[model samples]
Target: MIEQFLTSYFVKNGEHLEVPPKYISDTIKQYTVAKQTARTYRNVSFLKVGQLTKTKPSQELINYKFTKNAKRKLTEDFSTIQSWIKEGWIIEEIVFAQDGRTAKAIHYRIGPSLKYYFDAQNEQQTQRLENYVLQLQKSADIQPIKELLQAVQQLNEFVAMPIEKLAHTTKLTPHWSIEKRLRFLHFSIGFFQLANEGVLFDFKEIGATLFDKIGGSKAFDRDQKEFIEELERVFSVQTIDCGLISLGKITPVFFTGELMGHLAIIDKVLFMH
Candidate 1:
């Protein structure tokens, strides 16, 4: 699915069979795609046969192995994976030998980098989503999230607390605490936003600890990584760069009366359910 999307992205924008590298960034964001991890693909190829057009590359056969239950979903958003970019693997420049005898033109676009959380959607549709979020805030099924906030209020070691300690202290198994699978997708929006603001220093870590992917999800699901990607695409969410701030003085969040009240609204309405 992801490979197909990547292929179509260029084709849709191309006036001819081949697309220039200039369109990659905008095309990726338009589709809400994150990272393109699929290895082999016909980055740019000419079609020999087509149902509609024989000359257009739109009908080209993509050289991809479609497998069952592949992790094809666009998971990550605009990534700060500087390493991939530095190594030039994110967008590899490959040269295909012409007729397997001489060098031909090179293809420089094959992968993606960023996709927005909610991009180019109609206002009414987005409003409906916002209303759904409001509904979730008041939902009764959010006991676990509410309970986690209460636990954090009492525990000074909330962010840095060990998962085992949290489970023991809360009288719940780590397994029980995990929001089942894709729930992490819709669920962590506020948390990611807060994390982006550097308010939830341990938000990502605590999230990972809670949902460690035990025995795979019962249904098709996405993990914290996917959730983070989706959230970051919409909002500028990222971890605290330790170099920017002093880590030695990193103390726990003091949960006092006013603080608890503030956290209650944030944790309950923003993060829960």
Candidate 2:
């Protein structure tokens, strides 16, 4: 009967034996049997070797050592082991030994929760997750222009003031105001009443006068006509399509989309007056 019980309960495929024959024999001897029962207890020894045959022979049993802190949190029993296994603990094997008159077994294997707990506690993994979340939050804070435009449909006072101030504070030359400059010429030359009403100007006379005024013929060059044309386009009272005039001559010449009028000092005084 002892042999059958050992065979049924003590050994199975993939199961680890927990307790040596000496311990099993001692346990049976303590059962307060009759003096004649010593032989029967001794007979149970043969059953132990057969029980060992049922267990996985190649796999060795493993024992785990835990620090005091870890041991406090990992206090466990048979039910705890069963629960852990049910929750995915991988039971590699079990260790069996005999201590004095008692048979003892200690489960030894890696549990899935143990791995998960350590992974969660790892500093590197925690820092990585924190950095990822911080980056996501920073990205979320950046407002897309279209989305910003959608918010607060009408420009608020706070938004408008800075733009207005910027426009006012920006420095610009006195010459840039087109409204303050004249765009039409309606002057009479003595009694002749020459309207000379366009961007027309005599480049030869202007260049000669400029050289005489500045006392340098080198100052007057072939590009005088082109420069005058550009000056007219930039600061004169007439458009480019307007014909040219040779200041007191009657030929009424037209600039071939090239010559322009210059903004003279007299013109500036006239504008100011």
- Index of the highest-TM-score prediction: 1
The runs of at least 3 residues in candidate 1 whose Cα sits more than 4 Å from the true structure, single-residue gaps closed, are: 1-135, 138-185, 190-200, 203-222, 241-273
Tell me the whole-model lDDT of each prediction, alpha carbons only: 0.32, 0.30
Task: Find the 10 residues in a row with the least total lDDT in model 2.
Answer: 183-192
Count the clashes in each prediction.
3, 6
Listed in order, each prediction's TM-score against the native is 0.18, 0.18
Give the Å shift of residue 47 in candidate 2: 22
In the range 1-273, model 2's lDDT, one tens digit per residue, is 333333343344433323333333322211111111333321111121211111221121113432112222234665554444443332222232322233343333333334334445555655754454343333233222442332222222212233224224222123322211111100101001111222344434433432345533233343444444443443332322333344333354454665555645673342211
Q: For this target, which candidate reaches the highest lDDT against the unseen true structure?
A: 1
> Model 1, range 122-234, lDDT digits (tens) per residue?
34555654554444343312223332443223222322334334334432223533233124333443343233343334433433433457532222233445544543443
